[model samples]
Target chain A: DTAVSQTPKYLVTQMGNDKSIKCEQNLGHDTMYWYKQDSKKFLKIMFSYNNKELIINETVPNRFSPKSPDKAHLNLHINSLELGDSAVYFCASRKRFQETQYFGPGTRLLVL
Target chain B: DQQVKQNSPSLSVQEGRISILNCDYTNSMFDYFLWYKKYPAEGPTFLISISSIKDKNEDGRFTVFLNKSAKHLSLHIVPSQPGDSAVYFCAASAIGANSKLTFGKGITLSVRP
Candidate 1:
């Protein structure tokens, strides 16, 4: 079993369309995070949820929203996606008080 | 602004030799540092880590050295193997930041066999 997994490994959609990326972790971690990697390979944190509560929110656009129905699953929904939003989205999780984060394979989203 | 920086985008080393990857951070608040290895089409896997309180931590063939005074850290792989070829990312976090990692662009390590 995968420690972390994301749905729609590759997403191709037209600009202005809405899309959602689903994430799940089997590591039984309390902290879950979403990170975006741009074309330059720069990884930036977008949101973090701890125990089903929003803990960290970067200066990401409001069009991007994260929902954590439970500690194991954290989903990201993007509204009015733009071409600039095309990048790989990663889901990560770690145990409480643990410094290491385990990441998912990643979802490659392309906005045409 | 990038808090953590891996100046070298790519590095080449011969197998069975020593491989050293360096990282620097501008933020003094970072108390924990980590290195993750990523292969094509895969997520990053935690390789090694070190806390600011300590200078060195080792795991098998991997070792991490943290120089807090210099705000620098380095990952050393002894007897590097071809399997060690991958992109290594440098990450840091503050103690009270809930371990929210700040990642560098990453460095591609090539261990030529």
Candidate 2:
């Protein structure tokens, strides 16, 4: 079974539209996180959830929402997207110790 | 505003030679450092890591060294192989809060056989 998986491998949307990228992990990890990688390849953490509850919500705009329905699933929803939103979004899972983060295939979102 | 930085955008090394990838961090608060390798169209995979308390950590041919006072860390891959070609990223996480990591811009390493 796949340890971590994310849907919509590619997404292209117009500005001001809403879209979502879903992620699921069967590793039974308690922690889930969302990371954004810009064109320059710098990675920044956007959000983190533990057991369906939000834990680390960075300074991201309210348009970016992370919803964890259960311990195994975490999804990202974006609203009123902008051109700057064109980047690769990755979903990751890790244990409490933060020992290692297992990442899933990223979703490339392009807002025009 | 970038906390972690990898100056070299790319490097080429012959097989069986040593590959040294350097990384620097501006934040002294970063206590844990890690190295991750990524292939094209794939997520990064953890290669190695070192804590502030330990200056060096080694796993097989990969050795990670940290300089606390200098806030610099490097990953050395002895006898680099062609299969080792990929983009390597340096990451740092602060102590006490497991608060996610800050990654560098990444350096592409090409190992020629």
Interface RMSD for every prediction, one decimal? 1.3, 1.5
Compose the digit string of candidate 1's lDDT tens values, residues B1-113: 88999999999999999999999999998999999999988889999999999999999999999988899999999989999999999999986646699999999999999
Worst 10 residues of 1 chain B by lDDT: B92-101
Sorted into a CAPRI-style docking class, model 2 comes out as medium
Cα lDDT computed for each candidate against the true fold: 0.95, 0.91
Which residues of candidate 1, in runs, are more than 4 Å off? none
- State the fraction of real interface contacts model 2 keeps: 0.61
Model 2, B1-113: lDDT tens digits are 98999999999999999999999999988888999999988888889999999999999999999988888999999989999999999998885434688899999999999
Query: In candidate 1, what are the lDDT values of residues A1-112, reduced to their tens digit?
Result: 9899999899999999999999999999999999999999998999999999999999999999999999999999999999999999999999988888999999999999
The candidate that achieves the highest TM-score relative to the unseen native structure: 1
Q: Give candidate 2 regions above 4 Å deviation.
A: none
Leading candidate by lDDT = 1
Q: Give the TM-score of each candidate.
A: 0.98, 0.95
lDDT (C-alpha) at residue B70 in model 2: 88
